[model samples]
Target: MMFDNKKVDSGTIGYFDTQQENHFFDRKSARIAVAKLSQSISAFANADGGELLIGVEDDKTWRGFASVEDANPLLDTAFDRLKSGYFDAEFLNSDHFPGFVLHLSIERSPSVVYSTSDEAYIRNNAQNKKVTGERLDSLRRSKGDITYESHAIPASLEDLTNSETMIHFMLESDRISEPSEFLRKQGLLIDGNPTVAALLLYSDHPQGQLPHAGIKIYRYETSGEARRDFLSGVPLTIEGPIYTLIRRAEETAQKIIDSIPRLDQGSGLTKIEYPVETLHEILTNAVLHRDYGTRDYVHIKIFDNRIEVESPGRLPANITPQNILDERFARNPLIQRGINRFPDPPNMDIGEGLNTAFQAMERLRLNLPYINESGDHVRVTIPHEPLASPQEAIVNYVRESGRINNSTARTVTKIEQERTIRRYFAELVDAGELAQRGSGRGTYYEIP
Candidate 1:
């Protein structure tokens, strides 16, 4: 079965020729057994989801099926073995191909997917790893694919019902049901024990149950690496229920950020400004989406030039740094929903927190925040670096120092070329932002 009569360059097949099997892409011969193909389907759906080309061999050769009828066995297993809507299948052929290439694009399932033999698998790098025991449970917990938030804990129902937080929430929501009944209806209380979500939402000290559930904020004096010598004061621990914890952490961090000063044009030294929305969203996400399984609190480190928020988990589910703004997964759905019920909730827009933060940073002309997934953690760095142009930098430098020469402009803007600095000065002068004072070796520019 050929793709179409339409002709395309043989080089177009390079997509398969140069494609190496990785976490997101894999190729297999069409003669592979049904069970093995099922494993690949289960793996891609379990991990971040990926593309699988079933008609290609390990050595980058396109060994497609002889005909559409011959591909039915594999197609049936791919579709029938998994739940509907998990993947899409298409056949491809070019002027250079001898058979039809079966392409399957799988999505990361919200629930774990099992193969035909009921074995669960997850894709890791280039291999389909059969997951069991702790690894399987860890997979379920990541991105709230399974409902870990509703898992029962040792805390009593009274721990949630008697809390002042719950009481206020009930009153504000205008609910007349008893606190225990209300919590039970919300799936927060099971049997006689409070669930994880109930404890985090209503208990006075959720940290009492989950010791590492709160946040720790630190300030470093240096703009470089964080070391013992650069540490400012003692780290501040923000502990409470999830709602209070988020607010306290945000306010405290903002206060420290506000105290930092920067040189501005004509304003002299002014309070350094980073979009408040950016801090709020990132901080809120760091708390709500972090992995509770890890025995560490969310760490917020403030440096001279940036703020770093390290959450105690990798980006959940199919989420990667590149697609964080576009993907939505709640590691703790109940906690997220409960907080949204608060008066003027911390997360005003569900699933749009990071998107809001990115937009806010762009509006301020600041570089977008950097997100990286470390081993057991995800770190987001909010840099204070501006997107000002070279001419603007020169004008600002002259305004702050009363004068800027070629050497000084080069040093301030970090543009190593003296000619580039001179061009910037010329543009600033043409724009009337700076006035040339003299020529020859004594040349200097000052703000007009």
Candidate 2:
């Protein structure tokens, strides 16, 4: 799919030698067997897409092919393993190098890509891990190519037709069709049985059948690792139809957040709180977009300094934490549609929920939410800490302590790089706000 070739400079060649191989990049020699080359392409496609340089040696040497004809086998193997639109291949050439370097770019496919031998491989860190059994099924579900929600569940027709939730939903949405007809129209009924989406939306006690499809909230008094001694009370469990579940969970969480008090430098004491919109959007996203196939409830852990919302399932398709704000993929389309039909839907803006949550934090001068993926769940940690400029933090610390060192300043400003903090200190000194006293490790800055 790539039309133009990339011209490599001397600097680019040097970078290729020094750069380490990780999740997104790999280097292979032109002499690699055709079968091994196929596995690398499959691994990249199965996970997030990565780049493979075929002419690079294991020792970080530039040993390219003699001519275009010499690289044909590698190119042919890549194209045969991946579909047309799922990959791009381009040759890299430099006047400073001996021969051409084949560059193959692979993209995350909507479905799993198998090797020429008809075996599956997934990319983990820098290795190509073979997947089989349940993990393989999970890989397909996570990609959104197939969903467990579409599977049918055994239930009487009256269970859905006579339910109060279904009746109320139909009337509010202004649909005249009978309940059975509506379920059929929406693809929630299959082979005379209701699907998972139908049961979760209409059943008064969905947990009777799906016990883990709910929310569990815990309040921990400590900022460190959670322990039983730190737990304030018995964990509260909220279970009901999907609509009611979202509302009750949010209300309960807000009350707990309000009761916790924090000390403010200016206000003396105030209740710990986050933006209401942030809680609503994040909670709704966790419930609606989570993987119902996984047997676990969404978790809300309210720590003293932050709140953690853990939702089951990994990111679907090519969506990652880095690009979540710009990309959108729905694992449970039916659940999303059903919930959006409520009078005042929780997801009012749909795809912009996380974006809205982030902007609210910025508006209040608070730290933005941090997202992390672990095992089968994705967690979003919203810190109650405020955001202050590095220069402001340094000056304020010096005023209170009479002297500020590099280590203390880094902690105060939440900065990691020593050079960046030094730059800020230098700027403050040039402005006549502080004076440097010592050098190196013992360096300290105080009022002039």
Candidate 3:
């Protein structure tokens, strides 16, 4: 079987059985055991999603049920029984070739999922670890960092900002231009005291109040492969009010990007690797979405082939790597909203920044940025090269989607130059893989 829906290798056996994140198999058991299956299901959902192979053995050999038609019902029966109980199981799909492996893909739940025994378990490597006491509370808090941002700081208006900056914030939020009243209405100032958001936004040096609320940038002469910290020209730190920090950090990062060695975009020509808009959007997101509660500054490491911007805190709320494009959540709503009123604001559109950055990179035929999340931080990596050959990828896209335009082709192939799009389309047409259709301005291509 193969996950043709995604870009993965074609395999004939139970997929993800050996790989640990989500795959589980019970080979010794011939019948569908509800208790055992539900435990695995709950663990996978509570952590990251995974697959279950009912008949596969420890050695990766297939046994028992011969077809998906045969395995799905038995699995469904276990879920149906649990439906009216304390814990439940939801099986997405089961695919098998009768003599081969039965594969089931499980969806990870936003909240903690429990088994029939009412025990919530999270995955710790290959085993299911039960959550209790402080771990449970910590897991809930980690799910959404919004609670931390809502806390009012121990500072008063005098500690937060001067009257001028307060008046500016009031004006941007469309409130009566008074400091205390407007801030109180926005929940930023409480009885003449300021919230953490207000303190971070208005303070002369936010790092003085919040130790980790800054950015640390490094320029390495060698690529990250070298892992040579000494090779870096002394690190630079950008700290101040959120507004000032963004400006200084962006200017400094841009200078480093501008002066870096040009990269050959696999087309034999060396050019500046990343688009300015792409860099701006990424840098803005790193600053705004960071967790100010932690004592870790956002770290930006620039290398020859790639640039990595690692922001403090995990992804806020239910936003995951798979659902980031569609799900929107604000960890610091007050600060994010306040920053947008600055002249030529870096965070022009809050939710659309990432999508816009992706499109901008696609225009240049550069590899789109990727997100990596750990327990404490989310890191974004933007590289100079495309994930695949743009010309080849565009052709495959046209073949699959039926037709495409010059503009869409540019985005799909990461070809920023319009002439390049035309040339690539011409090449596909000449090879009889696609045929040009419609007239000028209404031009498109379809698989021939």
Per-prediction TM-score: 0.73, 0.77, 0.68
Name the regions of candidate 1 deviating beyond 4 angstroms: 1-15, 60-62, 81-98, 167-177, 220-235, 259-270, 293-296, 312-331, 348-352, 370-379, 389-448
lDDT of 1 by residue, 300-414 (tens): 9998789999998667766778888887777888889988988898988999999899889877778889999777689999999887777777777777779989988777666
- For model 3, how does the per-residue alpha-carbon lDDT over 164-231 read when each residue is reduced to its tens digit? 55556656657655565556777886566677787677777667657778889998776457555444
* Whole-model Cα lDDT of every candidate shown, in order: 0.83, 0.87, 0.68
Provide the global lDDT of candidate 1 against the true structure. 0.83
Q: Which residue segments of model 3 deviate by more than 4 Å?
A: 1-43, 51-106, 112-121, 130-138, 161-164, 167-177, 189-193, 223-231, 263-273, 386-448
User: What pairs collide in candidate 2?
Assistant: none
Residue 364 lDDT in candidate 2: 76
- Residue-pair clashes per prediction, in order, are 0, 0, 4
Highest TM-score against the true fold, candidate = 2
- Residue range with the least summed lDDT across 10 consecutive positions in model 1: 1-10
